[model samples]
Target chain A: MAVASDTIAAPEHSAEGRSETIAFLIMTAVLIVAPFFIYPLFLMQALCFALFACAFNLLIGYVGLLSFGHALYFGWASYLAAHAAKVWGFPPELAILTGAATGAVLGLVAGSLAIRRQGIYFAMITLALAQMMFFFALQAKFTGGEDGIQGVPRGKLFGLIDLASNNTMYALVVVIFLACFLLILRIINSPFGEVLKAIRENEPRAISLGYKTDRYKLVAFVLSATLAGVAGGTKAIVFQIASLTDVHWTMSGEVVLMTLVGGLGTVFGPVAGAFVIIAMQNYLNALESWVTVIQGVIFVVCVLLFRRGIVGEIAHLLRIKL
Target chain B: MFEIFGIPSNALFSQLLIGLINGSFYALLSLGLAVIFGMLNIINFTHGAQYMMGAFMAFFLLQYAGLSYWWALIVAPVVVGLFGMIIERTMLQWLYKLDHLYGLLLTFGLALIIEGVFRNYFGSSGLPYAMPDSLRGGQNLGFMFLPNYRAWVVVASLVVCLGTWFVIERTRLGAYLRAATENPTLVRAFGINVPRMITLTYGFGVGLAALAGVMAAPIYNVSPQMGSDLIIVVFAVVVIGGMGSIMGAIVTGFGLGVIEGLTKVFFPEASNTVIFVIMAIVLLIRPAGLFGRTA
Candidate 1:
């Protein structure tokens, strides 16, 4: 089993190196030219969700921990960042950082509590914890309950560039997303990541090997939460609002769908998955109530037969790492 | 004239009664979850939706078919159980070879589809399921007013939960079920149909959830959103109870429900979230859950 994993790891390592180059090139081209073709705001929304899905993938794919409650971190951070920028008059970068920090702290606490069990129990724990957050947001005055914290100012980026313009905001988001994405990629290839994979395959074996598995799992959880926070924070700025929908259990499930649909273990799978799902959502949103039914169908289909997901299947057919 | 914690005994007792009622539903639902988990190794995310389906079934029976609540009680669970059986046979049976997480994901998807369709057909707003004429009105306890229907709910759920417990824990049939849960292949070797047992177990679990829905209809508004919200709290309850023991799920369910009621009295703002807070604490102190065996 170890040898099989290592063989898989070898291809993945070379694949990661190749994909990073491709990603960087694609991002550069998009930054330079895509704005002319696509709407900046739409692109910004996609980037935010893309980052969120990638962060989510970090835990589920790499660590083999499927968190059904990630929206707590993402939604809470969005609320904090929205409130900070809108109510406290903070700069965009600071607000975003504050959101990420909040998510890391929350992840630390939630991870400590959730990592007590394995597999299905772990998923349930995270889900229940996130639901608790949803209730908190529903009642907390700062969250404004159903009204939410709306009309948030985009504020200035790094105290210099004005984000009120779509083009500048898009550029800013693209940079933040690329940095976070690369950071995830780097972590996946690190020794720390290998231990996570080992733990994923067999925790008892990993523990017997004298590795402090808990510490590694905790760090991975925190990192995933923090990056998800970054995505949520960016989303708040782009939408100029943060609502209960951001924190709902449904949102958490949506992210899971994105990751699963993209490819669970693949590095770039979540990004591809997020784009496809977000675009599908966008298209379905025009159809009103049918969106949820369609999303549900997609989820069932994916789980029942399409386990490799869009990117995973593509990677397999193309004979290349995603 | 009795007093506890500086509050009137009437108010306290009344709240306790409400807590017990809520706990009954929780106990029933979590019991179903544990039973399903035992045999199928799948957490039925659609349990809540199916529960909602029970209430809807009762409502539709009354509204369209002119059947009474008593009749619906007998029929709703059977209908919902049949739906569950079909689901297990068709879609869920395919997932047994994959990771357990896939089962969770698949059930969650089914839940979404069920809830979404219900919401689309019925609208997001709640529909009222009127109390049957036979079960309407209050009992008027000397200290506190005990609504007759509420008392009926509490008693009915307790009976159902206990009956389920008996079937799963005490009966010879239950021994076969337990043996299958422990080692299905061995049970199969003994000439017991393990696969059929799994399908029936899932059906029975779904039926339990539907029964809870029937009990809950008059107490809470019969809404499309009803089960989706309640299921998450039940998930926490399951975690707290550890899904290890039948009686544990029952005890934890009722205990958490009472605690939540107390929170309502002490801090109304936290009422909705108290169960989750307790789950967090439970996870910290007893990660395997109160009744769950250490993994």
Candidate 2:
């Protein structure tokens, strides 16, 4: 089971070589030109969510782990970064790093706790833990409960470059998102990624092969959480607010939707998925009340009929590795 | 004058009673989830929504049909159970051959739809469900005054949980069900209609949630969001108890409830998070859960 599943690792192999070069060029061109066709802020938001979803995919696709509490890391890190920048007057870059570090620590604790059980139990454990954090945030003084930590200052990037300007901020976001995306791609192509696939396919076999599977899962989980935090923290800087919405269970569900719609386990699928879903959400936000129902319908349709998702199906039809 | 750790005995007992009451609901919901998982191998993410539906069904029954709580007790489960059958027959049955996670996703979608529609129609605010007149008022229990309705909820849930255990563990039908759960193909070879049984099993599990909902309506306000929140806590209870044994689920549910209640008295700040803390500790101590078998 481990060996057969390891074949999926080959996809990551191609992802690192020429494919990555093409992807980098395309993404660079898009980032450079996106502001001309679209609002820079909207593009920044999409990029943030795209990075969040990709980080999430690292766990579900490669490790076959479905986390229902990812919102905890995203939301908590956002809160941390927001507090640092808004209250403590930290630079934007420092705030982002604070958020990422917070996520890594949270991921370590949550991952250690969740990895005790496998499969559905793991998902439920993470979800329950996240809910605990939700309650903590609800009652904690700094969170401001329903009001949340609002009107956060973006501050200058590295205490030099002002992010008050739209274009400057957008460029900063693009740089961060691209770096995170490339880092994820690199990690997935490495031997570490192959081992993760091995554990996902067959845990006992991987253990028998003398691979300390738990450590790999923990590392992947922490990495995923840290990246998700980066996205959330960046969003806080962009929007100048970090609220309960980021940490809510619905946010976790939205990440799952992005990954599923994009293509689970595919490198670029989550990014594309994030763009499509965010665009759909932007359109649906106009209706406001009806959005939940629409989201529900999409979930049903996706699970039942479109399981392989848009990119996965396209890849299959084209016979080109996604 | 009597104090336990600087807290009044009355306060502690009252919290313990509240804990027991919460535990009863947790036991009922987690038991339902475990039973559904047994045969279907799918976590019924819709269990919470179904529980909420039960409360709504009761509300509708009383408002439109002029039915009493007695009638609701009898009719609500059947109504929700039938709904469960429909969902299983049309959507869930098709996914049985696929990964179990798909079932979780599908039910999650169903839950969102149900909760969304209800929220859209009723708004997020809770509706009042009057306790039956007979179960109203309080009983003087020496140390603490126990609300009759609260006491009844605990007893009733206990009866239902035990009754289910009896049916699944002792009855010939239960034997067949267990046989089917272990090896559906082999059980089918014996001419048992395993698919139909599977559908009904889902109905039965759903019915258990509805029963809890009916029991809970008067205590907690009948709201669309009620079940969704409670369901996550119950999932934690299920994890702590380890879904390996029915008794384990029941005991853990009630035990955690009491523990949470005690936390409320000792450290009110941590009341909401005590169960999760316990869950983390349990994971560290016994990863397979207290009664769960090592895979």
Candidate 3:
């Protein structure tokens, strides 16, 4: 009976896996072809946010940790990257690395403090810390205060390839997005990821099974932060600006909104969510606070009815993973 | 006036008074959060929004209904608390069965909607609420001047906080609340309406926040974003104090406010972050908090 159950589950799992791959392939193809039809600037912004959301999902979906202040990682990294490029005269690649490194360090400090608390306290702690950082950014001289470090030069990717043109920047963004997305996929499917899931499912049980759950959580947080930094850094370069908007509590909420709308645990959910949310904000720019109201309504509705999110629901209907 | 650490006595004393006033709001708000968390096992993210609502309620009453500050003091919290009860019934009750995070998310969403709507109508600017005729002007304490309205806020919030503490920690009703939190099923089996108690408890906690808001209108700007900003600091206060003890929340709230005020006098740049920094240190030194019992 056990063997029969195992055999039945194996093929279904494989089918889900195959569907996920197909979805990724299709998503990549759409992203590649998207710029020609849609505005490249919008697409790049969406892709950066998509990457940011994916990094955020790494912690929330897989680890069952809802960080209410991911904007700390994304926003600070953007500032650092822009500063590095514009002030220090670094190449784009080096500037982005600086941003990622900042994310890792901040993640270590934040993760250590935050992991001390469980559930709701964890969320609150993250938010408070992020707010602290927001104030710091507002006062810090290096951050340019309210104006932020603007007019960041889109230097060469590696001191060789010119990235001034929209097409080149778009290509570079797509590459970075794909690379990071795949890395996240690889991380989630690894032995490390299984333990993360184990910890998430039952931390005490994982401890009983001799897992140092905190270390795993910390590592996952760092990795997530690093990727978020990459996205933020790329955004700074592409947009030629890194401002308070990226680091604000609202930005953190926006990332959470994207993840919630996309499907918390689904692989493709954040990407789909990022695109939808970014598109809405772009189109609804005229409505001002109404956009906030609409986003809030979406949040309420998503929590109440569409908990599985866009991709999650579709995956469920198709009986496949996304 | 004498000097303390190169700062004049009057400057220091006035800042201390300002801190005390801010602390009063913190103490009240955190107290409400602790009560709600005790019963509901959820952090009331909408507490901030509700507080904002209370202030807006006071503003609306005074503007449209020709109500006085005294009338607002009595009326605003009840109205806002009733609204809180409606939310508890319609939205919050549904979330009790799921992960606690959903409660936070849902409340956060509600807060966003409320703040967004208010901002749309009122814009980001603050509206002034007039001080009651009963509590106007200031007093000279020889070293520093004391504003009567500010002093009243401190006293009122303190009375409410201590009164709440007495009821929760001393009364027979408090025992039932504690019992319900421990085991709702057991409490319900004993013929008590646990669900209604839970709803009422949430409403009461929210009312406490509204009361603080009504008090705050005279001191701070009656603006939509005020509550959200203050709520983050209150969350840090809750963290440092830990949620396990009611006294912890109260003490931490007031203590942090004083510390914040002191920081402003000394290291003005760090004033915004001193509480958060203390929270981090607290988490490191005593993960369970100063007064919290480790679960």
Candidate 4:
């Protein structure tokens, strides 16, 4: 499996690598400059969601596993991170790490159960598990029931740099986002990633070739969950609260919508998708359920006519790998 | 009345009854899901929303049309089922060639749209659906008091479930349906309208969900969010049952409901999640599910 992947992936990387680098550079420049003109808080929220969608895409886009209950990881991480910062008085960095750890642990448990069944059953299992967590969260005391963990102190980054100011926090979020983005790119381009793609393309063939596809899928699931946790934790810190809304299935659906709108398997799709969705949510805040309606419409449209999404279409038209 | 397991019999019996009622709905919903999945190869994420629509349809009938519960039992399913058929024809027909996940996503979107639109007009609060006069009273069993309505719900749902089972497993039309499920191309060559059959199958499945919703309206109240909450639990039940056979879906649905009810009595904290816990254990033991054959 390893040898076969190397031969196939090596040539594709050299050609695709240049385009990916350019896209990354362009995205970084946009992140750095856009806050000057737009609201930093919105940017922070959008980036957090972008990271979340990217993590989600790692499973669906690359691994071909559609998890319908990812809000479990993202939302639980937010809760634990908020709890750590508020109740435990941990530093911001440590709290975020705590959240990420929470996601990894939960992902390990849920992924094992979900991967037991393939295809549609996998989605259902994950969703059920996530819903289970949601009920647990509702009953758990530290979550404060419906009120959630509010007024979470965004403590210093390393017990040195004060992150009370929006500018400092935005900068911190951007750095973490960029670092995670690079790590994801690196993972996707690695040998392990090639095996993951192979599993996605043909699990039985990969298994016949001696690849333990389940292990690869489990590892990918955990990685995606951990990154999702980071995104959720960061959002909790930025928003200064983590509520039931984060853990709800709707949040899970929202992430799916973002990834779909961006492009399912494309490198730059989730980021664009996240930004578009967050902007829509921010602007449509006054309309209440209409936002959900609009989101549903977009989902229908994307699936029916625009399955490639914004970035996927662009990449296709230009004959480039996004 | 005698006590069992250190608990009052009345409390235990009452919880058990509630569990049976929940199980009835679970059986109905999961049966619909299984039937639809068999023919359409889609998960029908909008089943819950359609169920909600059925309850709302009943409410609308009572409020505006001066129709009674009896009328609603016949009307709601047809209306909601027609709506589902329209959706299947216009949207779901295109997704037959794609990955099954797309169907799930598309239906999920449809669910959100339906729920959102309902929420926009009705708000999130529950609308009351009155109990019919004939089914309003209760009966005193040897051990516990059973509401006539609750008993009727169990019996009606059981009959419906078994009837569906019989139709699919025994009838000639069901034979055609099963044959189509196995190989649609071959069924089409044999002069059956596979596409129309698929649409009707989807509609029939949706109608069953609506029927459950109609039955559930009096007990749970008609609300937009009702279907979403219940649907996830039904999903867990489906996972446990394996969606392999109709009987499996019905039995698992009722059995899990009873188990959940028992948990509520013995361990209240875990009551809400007992089904999911059961699902996890079932997956560990039989990945294809208890009733499902390994595919």
Candidate 5:
């Protein structure tokens, strides 16, 4: 009877695995082809946010940790990358690495402090710390204060391929996003990922099972922060700006909105969310605060009746992983 | 001029008064948060927005109804408190079954909507609320000067804080609240309407924030973004004080405010972040908070 039950569960697992891979392939194809029809700038922005949201999802979805202040990581990286590119005259890729390193260091400090508290306190601690950084950025000289680091030269790729053209920059962004996305996929399926899920499902239980859950959480946080930095750094190169807006609490809320709208725990939810939200902001730019109002409504709606989100619901209906 | 630690007495005293005023706001705000969290088991993220609304309410009362500061002080919180009750009944109640984080998220969304709407209508600039005819002047305390309105704010805040503390920690009604806080399910079995209590508790807590807002209008510019900005600092105050105790919240709120004021006088660059720094240090030394007994 036990073997029969296990066999049935095994087929369900295989089906989910198969569907997940299929979805990723479809997503990849769409991402590659989407730029042809859509405006590349808008597409690139959405992709950066998508990658950012995906990194955010890795912590919240897999580890069940909702970081309310991810903008710190995203914004700090953008600033570092922009400063490195413009001032240090580094190559584009090296600038991005510098940004990622900065974010990792920040994550180490922030994650260490934040992990000391649990649940709601954790969210508040991250927010307060981020606010502290925001104040720091406001006072610090290198960030250019309110004006931010503007006119950041995209420079060359590995000091060879010129990236001044929009097309080259777009392609580079796409490639970097894909690479990071795949790395996220790889991490999510690893033993480390399983332990993260275990910790998320029940931290006390995971701890009882001899897992140093804090270390796992810290590692996941650093990974998530580094990737978010990658997205932010690339964004700075693409847009040639890194400003206070990126580090603001509103930006943090925006990422959370994207994750919530797409699907909290699904593979492709952040991608869908980023596009939908960015598209809304893009088209509704004339409407100003209405966009904010609309986002708020979506948040309320998402929390109340539709927690599964667009991708999660679709995945659930299809009996497949997203 | 006399000097304390090489700083002039006047500068120190004036800054201390500023800190006390700031701490009063923090105390009032954190007190509301603690009250709400005690009963609802959810941190009120919409608190800042509601406080902003309270200021707006007072502004509207003065502009449209020709109400005076005293009238707005009495009326604004009541009006805003009702709105809070509506939100509690309609929205926040639904989130009780889920993780406490959802409550934070929902309130945060509400805050965005409220602030966005207000920003759309009024813009981000601060609107000055005129002081009353009786409270326009200042008093010389020999070494330092004190504005009448500022002095009133400190006194009024003290009354409210102590009144709340007295009611909650002393009265018979307080016993019921304590019972509900300890175990709602057990209390509900004794023929009490626990859900209604929860809603009212949320409303009362929100009312305290509105009261603070009404008080704050004359001191700070009544801006839409005011509450959201202050709330983060209040969160740090709550963390440092430990949200578990009313007295803890009040004491820490005022103490940190003083500390922040002193930082401004000594190291102005660090003024904005000193509270957060202290919060970090507190988390390291006492993860639960100074007064917090539980995790």
Candidate 6:
């Protein structure tokens, strides 16, 4: 599968790769200038979600594995970071790192257990595992249960730059988002990423060709989980809170929806999707149930008729990868 | 009261009975999921929402039509089944050629829309569903008293479950369904209406979930969010059972529910998560599941 894709993708691969890079540059530039015109808090929230969706996209896009319970990593990290910052009085960067490390451990344990199943069972297993974490968070006293870890301090970045300034915090969030985004891109384009794709296209074939497919999959899962944790930790710091809402199944569903709405495998599609969905919530807060209905309708529409999504469709029409 | 291991025998019996009742619902719901997944290949994420709709159907029938519980048991499944058929015809059927995950996503959307709309109108608080006169009394068996309605739920669900098993595993109609799903083109070549059968199969599967919902109304409050939470657990049941056989689904559903009940008695804190914990263990030990075939 890898060799076959190489032959087919070789010709268009450069063009697609070039276009993707261009799109990334354009997006980064827009985002850099974005905080100047918009509410920094709202933009920070959107960027956080976008980063989460991108981490989620790495698995489903490159590995063809749909993890239905990703809130475990995201929410768990958010809580951990909240606790670390508020209780330990740790710096923001250190708290975020602590959260991401915990996320990696969680991914290693969960990803190993979940990889035992394939296809539909795989999705269900991840979801069930995440639900277990949700229950833990609910019952565990350190998590603060339903009330969550409120009044979490953002704290100083690197114990140097005070993150109290909206613009300064925005700069940190944007940097984090860009770094994670680029890391995902580099991972997928690397030789390891090719093997991951081959495994996705046909695992037996990849295994037959002497590749340890399971290890690759496990690595991909851990990377996705840790990256999702980073996004969640950043979000908690921005909002200065960590709550049950982040750990809910609906939150997991939201990440999946964003990835789908953007384009599963497309590089920048999740960012677009994250913005679109957050915007919907921000603008249509009054609609209540209708917002949920609309999200559902979008889910249905994306799956049935528009699987390529907004950015994906544009890229497809232009014969370029996003 | 007699004691067993420092616990009262009556308390144990009551929990056992509660387990049996919960098991019945799980069996019915998981059976429906297995049946639909057999033909449609979709996990039917909206199964929970449809189950809620079934309870709502009974609620409305009682409120406006003044129908009895007996009538609801007979009527709700049919109405909800037809609605499912419409969904299959209009939406689900289109995704057969695409990846099955798309169907899951699409049905998830449908579930959200259904649950959200209902929640919008009714609010999250549950509505009361009174026990019918015919099934309200309890039977005293010296050690423990048994609620007639609860017993009836267990019996009815068992009958429906095994009846489905018999039809699918032993009958000619079941053979045709097996043949149709395994190879529709080949089955169609033999002069059968494969498409119609597929549609009806989906309807029948959906009907089973509604039936369970109807059974649950008097036991639990009639609420919109009721099926949503239950459905997630049932999905764990389906995974643990492996969707390879009808009886496997039934067995896993009941067994897990009973285990969950036992957890409630023994370690109340873990009751809510025991099924999922067992699911993870099963995945590690027997990834194909207890009764499931290796995929």
- Candidate 6 docking category? high
Q: Flag regions of model 5 displaced more than 4 Å.
A: A1-11
Give the candidates in order of DockQ, highest first.
4, 1, 3, 6, 5, 2
Q: Write the per-residue lDDT of candidate 1 for residues B4-92, one digit (tens) a residue.
A: 88888888888888889889989999999999999988998999899999999989998999998999998999999999999999999
List the DockQ of the predictions in order. 0.83, 0.73, 0.82, 0.84, 0.80, 0.82
Clashing pairs in 2: none
lDDT (tens digit, per residue) of candidate 2 on B25-45: 899999999999999999999
Kindly list the per-residue Cα lDDT of model 1 for residues A96-179, writing each as its tens digit.
Answer: 998999899999999988888898999999999999889889988999999999899998887888999898888889889989
Give TM per candidate.
0.97, 0.96, 0.98, 0.98, 0.97, 0.98
Better DockQ candidate (1, 2): 1
- The list of candidate 6 runs beyond 4 A from truth reads A1-11
Residue-wise C-alpha lDDT for candidate 6, range A1-322, written one tens digit per residue: 5577689988887887889889988998999888878999999999999999999999999999999999999999999999999999989999999889878999999999989888878888888888888999999999888899999888888778999888999999999999999999999999999998888888999999999998999999999999999998998899999999998888989999999999889998899999999999999999967898899999988988899988899988988778
Per-candidate fnat, comma-separated: 0.76, 0.63, 0.76, 0.77, 0.71, 0.78
* lDDT tens per residue, model 4, A1-322: 4666578867887878888898999999998998899999999999999999999999999999999999999999999999999999999999999999999999999999899899999999999999999999999999999899989999888889999999999999999999999999999988788888888899999999898999999999999999999999999999999999999999999999999999998889999999999999999889867998899899999999999999999999987788
TM-score (second chain) of model 1 = 0.98
Q: CA lDDT of B153 in candidate 2?
A: 87
Each candidate's number of clashing pairs is: 0, 0, 0, 0, 0, 0
* lDDT (tens digit, per residue) of candidate 5 on A91-186: 999999988998899999999999888888888888999999999999999999989999999898988899998788888988999899889988
lDDT of 4 by residue, B164-245 (tens): 9999999999999999999999999999999999999999999999999999999997999899989999999999998889
lDDT of 3 by residue, A216-248 (tens): 999999999899999999999999999999999
Q: Which segments of model 3 are wrong by more than 4 Å?
A: A1-13
Worst 10 residues of 1 chain A by lDDT: A23-32
The 10-residue segment with the lowest total lDDT in model 3 chain B: B286-295
Model 2 TM-score, all chains together: 0.96
